[model samples]
Target: MKSLFSVSVLIPVLSISMIFNSWAQNPDFPWPEGKRMALSLSFDDARASNPDPGAALLDEYGVKATFYVVPSGMESDIAAWKEVVASGHEIGNHSLYHPCSGNFVWSRNKALEDYTLERMRSELSAANEEVERLLGVRPEVFAYPCGLTYVGKGERTQSYVPLIAEMFLSGRGWKDEAPVDPYYADMAQLTGMEMDNKSFEEILPLIEAAAENRQWLVLAGHETRTEGNQTTYLSMLRKLAAYANDPANGIWIAPVGEVAKYVKEKRAEMEGNLNIPGISRPAEGETIYLTAEKGKGIGPDIKYMPEWNAFGWFTAEDRVEWDLDLPEKGKYEVWMEWSVSDEEAGKPFVLTSGEQTLEGIVKPSGSWETFQKTKIGELALEEDFNRIIVASGEDFDEGALMDLKALTLVPVGK
Candidate 1:
């Protein structure tokens, strides 16, 4: 019998009404509706000894993946790292050090914060620069050292939101929690996995389940190879590759970066669904006209919070409006562009319609920056009203030159 997976319960939590039909799969918009899954084989805190076999398996099967390279762990295996990059696998910065940064205890540790912002800049930048120097490209993916999101045991409130919005396509933290809406956490800063003592049988089911759910299953591990003994790690890798390469089994193996890109793209597409019902955005290259007041303001009934950071650590206003039109109901996403006379960094702008909200925070590269998009969650629309509002959150002053460059209402499953 085929392996069983439980997705019904998770589906209600996910509420992905726009992206796929109940039976559709693979969310590349134009791609045919079929079950599409993505699997990422990520090696955490690089282990030199574990190189040959794992890379070989991926290479042999024509599969690509992401490897998280820590400064300490990669030095001894520079050649292998280069080879992996050359072989089409992506190399991502895994932090200079791999401390358990996720825990409240460690976030408060004096030694951790002792590395000031400048030091962090150098540390993370150095890793990217070095990887580029050797691999001919700077990596855009960053995973937290031990997956720390808060400082000294207190959450940053809306802090992580802006940080991820501005930079990095995606990131990984060390947590085994069940999936939540990527919007709540930075879609780029997602959860990852570490191989514990679970056997292949127990582990395989979980991997298969995640694949079935279309969740990006990130496998993190250390010491894939020892001086002489390489048993469990090798076995696990072989199993993963076998499952990944088998499309008949519904597993779509992709590089970690690619998976992130797909998820982000899907999120944006879903956002468009939230903007308007039965009106879908044309494929890229097709132009659409948007009103100055396409996305306006929030409704009085909903609670709204400030979306912090948005630009650099402190650039421009990164404001957002949530729960804007809960009752008007319809699927929609936000697509807009803006230019300011006085360039500012780190400002947040967003639009919320139905159950979804879209955000953008960055300095405009030009008078017109086109095609920037963000995803909104699942939504249901009611009759009678059709307009949605976009604005900064409850806090922060409004922005100048904000334009709804192009907006469209997309119908799902049409």
Candidate 2:
């Protein structure tokens, strides 16, 4: 039997160390065997057309794509879906009843606005169980139904993204505007660009741009019919497979899970090998300050407060990152300057450098204005460039993570 998925075979001549060092200074990701970019073709809803001409066309070119299936929709096409699995394609969970916003009249009966976190979790778990029982493969990835991720309306609204992050290897969103930056992307919410109803000519530009930037492009669609609403035309798929398979085009195409796994493994490899000596810190090590103004905040709720020279309005989903190039490899004692209300003092946060992470609990400084400096923990530094991230821990709930002023990294023993 063929493998469930395929990955680009790395060339034996290029050592992993050599590849990491070469791309250490360059911004572009080092694709396997020097491919310019990566692409993943995925279809949602598991429409009958997907297993017929869609998977068939892909198999002809030795391409493996991802199929996010609604388990309830798979009853009529079990045989064809088994063939899809046999041909090395991926099967992902697309929920059970395909709940969407109540705005869509057809889905009003199964609307997300009426759901609670517990109910959504039950449905997702049931869907996984059904899919596994039917297809003999438990899905490792997921797709948000109708691109909607929340479970309620207004103040009651709760994002189920964290749930997906905990349950699957990755979760993909629909109708996203850009390709994923492997370096900074949140794996749980990968961007899925639409390929439905687009001609090959229309899609070529997106592929070309991704190539230039060495990014990962995930193309999503519904059916595989030649002409229909929400359909990924067979003609376009043929041309795309041909273009990607051509070595001259410099594209590495694979299933979504395969590409995501590769990106994670490569990042781990790169971070693991950063201990090699190349630069030197001064005899008297310097204290590196990552001020709030200098840090880049990601996610919806984190904000910079110029009045306090700090970042405030933090939530569990928010993260603050700082890019640095350490002059030497050594242990650095980490310290955080922040303030939080007494009620929010127990929230936990983690500081990560490469593979090492230092976890600390938020200290109560009485009020947000009264900042306190506390030594969190120490982490070993890498000589090369590193992205330091401070993120909320699993235990965080309704309270704010903290109002951060700055993070300091002082050399432990200079």
Q: List the residue pairs that clash in candidate 2.
A: none
Distance (Å) between predicted and true CA of 150, model 2? 0.8
For each candidate, the alpha-carbon lDDT, in order, equals: 0.50, 0.82
- Per-residue C-alpha lDDT of model 2 across residues 157-247, encoded as one tens digit per residue: 9999999999998999999999987766788999999999999999999999999889999999999989999999999999999999999
Provide TM-scores for the models.
Answer: 0.54, 0.64
Superposition error at 358 for model 2 (Å): 26
At residue 229, give the lDDT of candidate 2.
97
Error of 2 at 389 (Å): 16
RMSD of each: 17.9, 18.9
lDDT of 1: 0.50
Candidate 1 shows a clash count of 39
